[model samples]
Target: MDAPTNIQVEVSLGRKKTALLRSLKMPLTLSFPPSPPPTVRDVKRAIQKAFPKFYADRQKLSLPEAPKSLSDDSVLLFDAAGKVELVVGDLGPQISWRTVFIVEYAGPLLIHPLLYHLPTAFYRTEVQHSALQKSIYAMVLVHFIKRELETVFVHRFSHSTMPLFNIFKNSGHYWVLSGLLLAVDAYRPGYSQPVVAGTWRDGPLLQLGWAIWAYAELSNLIVHLNLRSLRPAGTTTRTVPVGYGFSAPFNLSFPNYFFETLAWGAVFLISASPAAALFIAVSFGQMLIWAQKKHRAYKKEFGDKYPRNRKAIVPYII
Candidate 1:
């Protein structure tokens, strides 16, 4: 079979012009106990109130061009009446880094509180194709927690009684990993006659340790990023880290906001992994030392330009 390509589109009917303007209209009838029939004006007002932006959509109505997709999936579009209109190939990226960022970073903060400490999966060959994939799941959970910290600094305070609801405030900014999964599925879609089953093929015990460590690193990310953003007031001296001009404060830099992201990401992979603990621990431990070294280098070079006593990873250690 020939490989699939990467450009797709989903076509739908343009927004309604008025309450009376429903496409592929279906009529529903019911007997009411002497209630007044609803008028068209009331319907119009309700529609406008619900979707203010769609009210003025005057774009030309036609099917977009079908292009090749990055992933090997057929495209399907639906209208209000549930009919496929235009089916294009990949308009969206086959693999998006932003979605990877959120799933890998911000995921852990939420996961840790909910799912005890250790990772959910064991060394199951059936559930996961390889230990490497389980590591990936843990890794995504780590990033979710790390990135979620932004909820505090970026979002202004609200006195909402529902904390769960607040998490949705800037949710549009999230990277939906499901898209990647769907794209991948499209590329080589699965199901053996629609059968789904998996099992473990024996493994080590330290996976739990790695899982715990993964979540801990996630916890650290949230604190660090939020802390990193809120620098001490009235201290404007260096553009980059104190000594280094543009290079990061640390050797391996991602976003300046999420300092310890890689460290946690490593721990997630190493968790429940057949890898040596000393190796992973040493890696995480060294990251701390490196961060402190960079911080110290910055402080010594710029003096008052940098804050006096800012610990890198641990509270009062470095």
Candidate 2:
């Protein structure tokens, strides 16, 4: 058979930056320097190159790589003219339901440990990569749901006397997004197959907001800072898989990862039991507290570029 040409990709930076990457009435083909680039190998070869250490990992590798990633997996498609253009990771091959699981597991391995475990890797590696993990998490979480868990266990809208816990509102948004993806897959077996939902337009539209929020957090200040190292100026070069600030002792750290894990658990828990949903709210509280501090710091720094409309951890209110 001839080579398949149906491979598609959608690339965007964000709304304000959309024009930078989006194409109108055309597939999003990219150019290097001035000319269109060359074709490349498939996914298996790409994995071997980027992760020479993980030859075994590549043996039954289920994750997907961009079509072009196989060209030289170590280096993305950069033009010989020396002007960098884009990346396979940025405009990778389309993600599928099975591949989404691999992406989700990567979250716990790549994000949660770093978020709440290691000190050395957190500070040493760029926080942007760490923060991007959230984007990936949100992307993956958009794939699961339980009905009763969504409605019964947690309250979507209400006043929280605790500003720290108020961010559960955002969790609700994420949970809702997860629900939509679940609904889609639950009803439609394959992306090509048809499914039924009775006038269910509301869920997806609301979900877009949550996805945007997830993207926003993916680019936020906390995500920008790598917290892998916890040494003073003169302290020895000690490393831990993860570390928390002295103020944030190990006991305190669980609550953060717990918040993350529970956020996911809440999603799965929404239909099973309220206990998980309650934990979801609790985790929301911890995450909000974490974000509120930085939101305040930025407000103090910008003094003016900051908008009064800004809310720290949640979307609408501060």
Candidate 3:
């Protein structure tokens, strides 16, 4: 009948049938200030401290009666009539999203040049890499370098961590599909030779591709910088970014994705390789999915304040 002194959260494995009863019987009680109720993250941390095996990333906490996991910042409500039970599901091994990006990008950063210089390692006879191949190599290197720098310094991730197994899956996508496959095809004998064989090393298409690639690369950087400006360093806070460069119209929710797609398209145009084509196709598809989700979040978060005309990853015709 009197005001509650402190809330108690009983931890249990959500999937078990006897979880609720076991939790109530043997509860892992955590004390918190009544002024600010304990958040989901606070509860998870408490559970992790009590059970070392259940780290924050591995813990999916929810009310015993609720079907959905609680958001990290969601405050736990105390019940006067009954026990407060927190269900935790182990999400398996996990790693930081930043680590995942660095590891995956490292694949292409190292593999591209290795395959270019030491073709025999990949079971290909060495042919002198043409100026075009060198040029394409430079572009890909620059692209990945920018990605690494952004991951390390510029971009802020919304999600703190991801499943550990994703490192292999992501690395394979970057290493095998984007790096090795593209390099093998692009650096193959006679694949990148000049149109005039020797004298015209830098063909018109090569020049045009370089121009497009450079423009797209710089545009992508601008968009990234703008996005970074929305969120301060060391925080995941976000705001609607001011338009610049290709995103001047603010028509695309993910203008950076668009620019990267264009940049890869330029790489394909220059190399004229099937691997580059395939990589861009796969990359675009993934980016499109991410963009759609982000777009929906933006609309939901900002409501009518968010632009109604904005597309997900394209200018006007996503």
Q: Which candidate has the top score in TM-score?
A: 3
lDDT of 1 by residue, 230-252 (tens): 45433322233322212234322
Best by lDDT: 3
lDDT of 3 by residue, 1-318 (tens): 875677767776666443323433334666766557778889888777876765787777888888687888787777883347777776678899999999999988998888788877774566666878888889989999999999998878777899999999999999998888988777777654543255444578889999999999999999888887888776667676557733446478888998899999998886678899999999999999998998899989988988788888888888
Model 2 lDDT, full chain set: 0.33
TM-score of each candidate structure, all chains considered together: 0.27, 0.22, 0.89
Q: Which stretches of candidate 3 lie over 4 Å from their true place?
A: 16-27, 81-83, 120-124, 192-202, 245-247
Which of the two, 1 or 3, has more lDDT?
3
Q: Which 10 consecutive positions of candidate 2 have the poorest summed lDDT?
A: 187-196
Whole-model lDDT for model 3 versus the true structure?
A: 0.80
- How would the candidate models be sorted by lDDT, starting from the highest? 3, 1, 2
lDDT of 2 by residue, 1-318 (tens): 432333322222322222313332222243322223332323323333434432322222111333332322223333333322223232222223323333333332333333323433434422322222333334343422222222232222211122222234444444343333332222222211122122222235335534544443333212212232233333333222133211222222222333344334423322222333554566566677776776566567667755555444433432
**What does candidate 3 score on TM?**
0.89
Candidate 2, superposed: residue stretches over 4 Å from native? 1-272
Query: What are the lDDT figures for the candidates, one per model?
Result: 0.35, 0.33, 0.80
